[model samples]
Target: MTKFPVLHEEQVREFYYNVEFVEDDSLHTWVGNKSLYLDEELLEKILELPDMHCAGVQKKIMKGEYQLLFEFVNKVLLPRTEKHIMASSTDLFVMESLCKFEPLNLLALVLEHMYKTVIEHKGKHRMG
Candidate 1:
């Protein structure tokens, strides 16, 4: 279980807008699911970890302190993702590429999730 850092709207937009194309497709599909991209239950578990705390992660990404992002990507996000994608497939290269895509996809996933989360949370708060 691992918790992702809180990202601002501007940062999410920046990351989404700056994405590179993989062939004709926008590589956007690599990061899908606005709600619970990296296992919401697991994310919740990670968040509850005593050692964890929220940080302004997007700023660090913009500043190119990718190690922090990499840690979360490699250790927490990628492994779980790989298990699903690589389960039936045997191609190491594709698996490797997918693993690489994990971090970038993570950014995409987080941004999309954040956007949806804000909208949903606000909707609930306002309605309730």
Candidate 2:
């Protein structure tokens, strides 16, 4: 059994907000002409999971490892969102109330928002 890292909402927020973009000369010819890198410490911590072993998680991020992270975020956030929707009287109230409790739920919202932003950005930069 693999033990995944337990992430707090603050950590997730920090990770997304702190993303560093750099110029990759190799990718200069690519559509966006830019590259993004995550904090190495975050990657190391996540890779510590028993089932995960990689020479470099950052490299894998560009190769689609990020979808794995998104999946984890969804796994954490979806249940809570569902619970709130089922119990709350108003949809607006549920969203507003999401931030009142554990940070994990808030982190889920942030992750979902970021994921959508990335998809939109990628689509705008597509080679087509």
Candidate 3:
């Protein structure tokens, strides 16, 4: 399991203040005149799916070998309803995009996930 650091209040403030919306909504920071955008390192660590850079990923997807990809997206990325047994459009998109080595906007990822979660439980509200 990949561990995310617990951001303190100050850290969140620093990030909000320092962050920039660069290309395609990707988060960036300009430090010492250097523009920095985190790439696939974080996602790769999260997945730990071996042979990602190999030439066979697209082939596997094409063959409908979705078990591996589905596991990562459903279990690791979004631990929602266990009934999420098969990959949704969003899950497939992540697999396809990341497989193609496309740039990832981490901020967009978080926002999209939050939006989906809210949508999924839109009317199931319960007061404590």
Candidate 4:
């Protein structure tokens, strides 16, 4: 069996295409651009995850969207617990550990800020 659980190819494609890197402010934003150098066939077969940002959590922290942050934590940080355990309680606790404790410690605090921003602006149509 593969060490990492399989994720949908479409989901992985979306993640990569949606990821954006803002050049001016040094803040990498997910602009949902599909203009990358990845091969279509390869992208169709593999799942790519988001990288964490090292910048401060001011973006997520000031917005009071700790729950949203937690969700990201679950998605990015709880892979180990998710892979081995089937219990909801343990999974939930592992999810909580993103904030207080960590076993893998692979979670990136930087990209999380961008995640919070994207989620907050999800439904609105910004014309700029």
**Highest-lDDT candidate:** 3
Residues forming the 10-long window of minimal summed lDDT in candidate 2: 50-59
Worst 10 residues of 4 by lDDT: 50-59
Which should have the higher TM-score, number 2 or number 4? Answer: 2
The lDDT for every candidate, in the order shown, is 0.36, 0.33, 0.52, 0.40
What are the RMSD figures for all models against the true structure? 17.9, 17.6, 10.2, 16.0
Model 3: lDDT of residue 26: 45
**Alpha-carbon lDDT of model 3:** 0.52
Name the TM-score of candidate 3: 0.41
TM-score of each: 0.19, 0.21, 0.41, 0.19
> What digit string (tens of lDDT, one per residue) describes model 1 on residues 16-83?
44343333322331223342223333444555432111122222333233444444444464333222
Candidate 4: C-alpha RMSD to true structure equals 16.0
Could you give me the TM-score of model 1 versus the true structure? 0.19
Candidate 2, residue 116: how far the Cα is off, in Å: 0.5
For model 2, how does the per-residue alpha-carbon lDDT over 16-40 read when each residue is reduced to its tens digit? Answer: 4444333321111121333344332
Better of 1 and 3 by TM-score: 3
Report the C-alpha lDDT of model 4 over 1-128, residue by residue, as the tens digit: 66997778765546543655443323322335534433323333453432222112322333345556555644665433223212233334444455566442123332333444444443341311
Clashes in candidate 1: how many? 0
| Alpha-carbon deviation at 87 in model 4, angstroms | 11
Regions of model 2 farther than 4 Å from truth = 1-104, 123-128
